[model samples]
Target: MGKCKGLLERLKNNESIVVAEGYIFEFERQGRLKAGSFVPEIVVDHPELVRKQHEEYVNAGSDVVLAFTYYGHREKLRVIGRENELETLNRKALQMARDVADRTSTLMAGNICNTTVYMRDDPEAIKKTENIFKEQIQWAVEEGADFIVAETYSDLGEAMLALQCIKKYGKGLPSVVALVPHSKDHTLDGVSFPDACKQLEDAGADVVGLNCGRGPATITPLMKEIKKVCKVPLCCLPVPYRCTPEQPTMQTLKDPKTGKQAFPVDLPAHTCGRTEIREWAEEMKALGIQYIGLCCGNASHYLREVAEAYGRSPPASRFSTDMSQHFIFGNRKDNKPYYSETLRKEITTANYK
Candidate 1:
């Protein structure tokens, strides 16, 4: 099948697309992969699983089926003693994503993430980082990726490098570069959110915004600042977990009872519900953010909420919640027989004021 509409054309036509990410965390939760290394070996190990995830995200209204290569870079694989599988993983993941995107008519994004080897002052670390992005991008180009998503960089310098690498190696593909600032609301290099976005835009990023580290509550504030400065279309894909002012990023979030950081694992209970995702999407659309999605902890249901809020009715929306068909809270006449009057009375003691 031919490629779908490119990101720039979609944005020009006033389209707001949802891009789903977070494969590592979700796969880890399903026991298909490990956490610390977070290499996307699942692409080479469980191709069907990765394919299903891409299909589900498309069904859930993700307009872009980003290749599950977020951490499939050389450095990340080297950590797991699988650096030899780097090329295999990147190519396989991109191909899997392409198949799903072609079937669904969704855009396929080549994903290059932070190499974790980049250092602010180390020239060798920067070169390694550039090399990692360059090789992955070359494979994406060969695999027919519609665009490139360079994401999860905490260092603005590294993000700039990724953008440069994409321009150099991506063969003119659009680049959606996203940053992940911690609780400080600035990059490790001390660049504020808005300033970082402005710099990316000036450097010719097709899209720039925040993703991953913060949730809706914490990320939105940073996005607001970015929106004020960036002329390019903005992208915002926050984590699905709840983040507050004090606990501004998932890494800082503590289990209320245990008082320990709840990130990476032990965060299922703190995930944002459908309502919160819907509200977050609504607010982002209102702010004119063009690309919206979820990062770590993302699921199909959450993407459904974001898509619905953006006025889309994807295939998965067929199963959206219909409380009227419920047993207790349902007001449908057909549901009356399912519950006794006494049961209803016992279940619902309060009514709307």
Candidate 2:
């Protein structure tokens, strides 16, 4: 067993310690300063940017800093004409994470997800997927990853395959299998949450739970259901978007006039704030969740709030001598109705013919 396994065992024995896993794909996507998938390309061109994100998470109190390899698989890289850079991408991502984690004595986790190509009928495709997972896991272990996190998997079969790969190639490193469910009860492939978690546990997952499909509000009940069946330490890293079962993805937003899809980051209407995340962390801690963390759209400020809620010292960026001075934009000195002259004139003007 590896260090993460030992840490998880200590946590499971009621050690009163909480592990925070902070994801960086969304943060990196935003930092890429353009509109496209920021996978292997970012790892090749912006290694420092990736390192900076890892540093921020570590400073924000993340116990584990995951490598920015969420979509660095071969198939995903092929879409951007960089499939040949798979080894470099995965190794560099792990190195970047290890570098940042070393500075703060934080754990580093290697990440793998679904390949987006589930051809159960095609044996050749299955072999390809298996090889991809095997290679990724090997690199993770070789690159000094403290653990392996197989996340955002919508299919039970694929999730199990990832776990199997880790067990076979990860050399006894701790592994977490987090499923992306279609609803509160079942995974996207119609497998019940309990059944999915149970299968992963049986397949040697050190921890199992949900991530990336919904927010804390929706995932709370799902976590309860998982608790009823899964005996291992649970992991819940919900996406920060305000989505529901009816609308799983954030791509549902279409422009009213142009009918073009808008990005979730561009709209704050569905984003989770610090207060909500802190409340969610409190609830999870009460529910005996040992591995608590954030998923997509997770920022340093959000993780700082979670850390503070758990009675841990928040990052320096979130600390201040005066509580009222915590707001980046200073609070108003007085309560008064104020509006721009153009908006006020528009409100008072009569309709034109």
Angstrom error at residue 263, model 1: 1.4
State, as a TM-score between 0 and 1, how close model 1 is to the true structure. Answer: 0.96
Model 2 residue runs over 4 Å out of place are 1-6, 15-40, 244-267, 317-322, 325-353
Of the candidates shown, which would achieve the greatest lDDT relative to the real structure? 1
lDDT of 2 by residue, 177-254 (tens): 999865546776678988899889888898899887677777778889899998888888886666555555445534
- Candidate 1 lDDT, 38-72, residue by residue in tens: 77788999899999999888899999989999888
Which candidate has the top score in TM-score? 1
Per-prediction tally of clashes: 0, 0
Question: For model 1, which pairs clash?
Answer: none
lDDT for residue 53 in candidate 2, whole number 0-100: 73
Worst 10-residue lDDT window for candidate 1 reads 332-341
